[model samples]
Target: MMRAILPTRALVPIAGLWRVTACMAGAALFLSACGATTGGPGVTPGPASPVVGAPPEPAVLGVEMSPERLAFTPPHLEGMDLVRVGVLLPFSGASAALRSEAGHLLRAAELALFERGIENVVLLPKDTEGTARGAEAAAEAAIADGADMIIGPLLAAEVRAVSGPARRSNIPVISFSTDTSVAGGGVYLLSFPPEEEVRRVVSYTAALGADRFAIVAPATPYGQLVSQAYRSAAAEFGGTVTAEEVYSGGVDSMSQAARRLARAGIGSLEVGRALAMTGEDWRPTDSGAFQVVMLPAGGDDLRMLAPSMLFADIDPLLVKFVGTGLWRNPDSAREPALANGWFAGPDAEMRARFETAYEIAFSEQPSRLAGLGYDAASLAVVMAASEGGIDRAVIEDPNGFLGVDGLFRLRADGTVERGLALYTIRRGQFEVLDPAPVRFGPDSMAVDVEPGES
Candidate 1:
């Protein structure tokens, strides 16, 4: 049992522990819950600062149960604590439309744990109907089944529903959704979301000293939001939006949109990147006016639009391409012609190694998504086995980087801190041009230079 170390307000850093001044304990039962051993980070929370309280303002309302206090209790059945690891995914929904990618990943993840000699790892799998409600149902069912932990609900909204219930149950969640918004108590997302991808991309592209960028995406909100995120993040680093393009329904129908660029005289986003390489505070007014093209889509879509873009007299390489984690797939980098395209993702060799281990165990190549599954399950097992599983010190353990996802930490918010690598394709393979970085909230981190940055 963790002794609630509640420190009064105005207390200075008393030997470095986080102090929380609160009304003395009045433990009235709101809900009858069983007690279990509590454990996690024993690290010190940063020092507190004073806040003025003169003016009356709206008070922040909170839910009944504070998610942070929730603890994960492993069930010991027959002498061994058989962790009921629940995997909630859409194995039969629209995800099936993606050719059983989810199932392949799921199996591979389980197999990885099994190979590690962690035999008592009981697998509890459930299928959501590829909808928010389905995801919620799956999560609730998992909790009802005595699952000590929940693995995934793949989508963002699904994560939202899963988070609350998991928190209420004090069950820690390791999700595959990349949406940062889904992160909170009991939820730890591993999907390389747009924000993480964008941050790495902007950091890499910024080093070129070119401050102008052009972005394009489908007409959907997802597309607009990603584009907007890139633009806003780009300017925060002193960059400029010289040109922007919007297409409808993925890059497959972006041919007409490609032509629109010729009129913009934007030349290529690649040129802008090259300008940034000058290592100066070059703005849109600094040199070649404006030129850049950033497409938020996959390599297949990138390929389809290539011919049209080229036929329109647009130099493909001249317009250096910038992309998100979706481009992390080997197939995405296989266009061969996309050798110059820049994207943020896991290290290729790291993925190759994981795939080798997976294939040896399962007799087949693991899906790309499996990497996330492996990281999530493996981390949970290790964390649970630790003296303090979800404690702030453990979650913030400086060394607890999720190897598969590049680098991430379990933050106090119960959300994860992500940092994916910045890679460029060369000779049909992704070469690590820059090391990954920690995602600083919603802001873009400054790009680091390697020994031979050109």
Candidate 2:
């Protein structure tokens, strides 16, 4: 008989009702479900924050459990080999925000097992408590418990903590953290990387004749990363960056950068015309020239800077506003100035299906990061059922694996590559500008269509 060892910490059951249904295609499982539940006092609830080199303790909310769970232990079958997978998450304490949707995440993974009909595998949960020390301890414990592979420890710090232990035990780890710096040494990152997002958008935009690009980003570390990615992608995509500007994240600095961007000959004709029509004192110091202006920031930051561009007489129609995956928000559409702006992100169709299934399975919307768990577990299931059984070669397959977010693969360097699609803000919604490729093409980007397509 299979045994499940629940965490010792008391966790109130999540309040709601959910119905789960699995879509099976041979050994692959796709989930579709119904229902919704808003979090209550007994559960951690918030958006996940980024974790860099080190993360300080953060305020936390109560941790809770769902009354229902997909069976992680498969039914016993004669002569079947058993595969053990471990999941590490922040179940309680300060870092709980990183895994506020643990219940939904677990359910999604379970749905994967159920749909695949893989009964010989077992998934064990370990609480990392949202700390590096906790992650190390949990990893050691999980490995002692006979886990053949490990799924997650949400934050980068936790992943770093668990990496040592996992490597020592010769066990592979698939982390959900987006921090690419922590990846490598048998630790495969399943989280989407900003580099991939930048490359996709840049390449696609360049193909469309928007070869002259300019970037305005914040001066933070993430901003630095984005700047580097923009430069690299520009070169790779045969694009020329006429100007690059970094600001200190202040309104004044952003406004000044906008002034400088306007002087770089970007959309000069339209800028002059718009200024003429506005009858404003503002005049183009130099003819604005770049066809594309990439803003690697989003949210209120974008909202703040977007208008500044127009104030500088940069016409929206003359210059295409390009951004990173951060621009994938409905609110971005509400910004009249950014209506036709483009960004790169996962496929919307797949995201909707996954979200619906998660709500139905746990009676609550899954965390934005929950798909990481589902995809990691799904890959684990697929590998476990294969003849090699989670071999290193299998995990590093360049062809990648299809998940709710679309096609993604792990690289030899432990980085992740996702097949992202281009999207544009249209009518207060994001519309697909280019479908995410399902397979790799000769250009090292995702193919426009699946194999055997006309």
* Candidate 1 regions with alpha-carbon error over 4 angstroms: 1-77, 92-99, 119-121, 129-134, 249-256, 266-285, 289-291, 311-319, 328-339, 390-393, 396-399, 413-416, 435-454
| Candidate 1 lDDT | 0.56
How well does candidate 2 match the true structure in TM-score terms? 0.76
The candidate that wins on TM-score is 2
TM-scores for all predictions: 0.68, 0.76
Candidate 2 error regions (>4 Å):
1-80, 270-289, 442-454
Query: lDDT per residue, candidate 2, 181-264, as tens digits?
Result: 899989988887888988998888777666677888898878888888888998887777788888896778999998988887
The per-residue C-alpha lDDT of model 2 at residue 397 equals 77
Query: Model 2's lDDT to the true fold?
Result: 0.66
Model 1: residue 123 alpha-carbon error in angstroms: 3.3
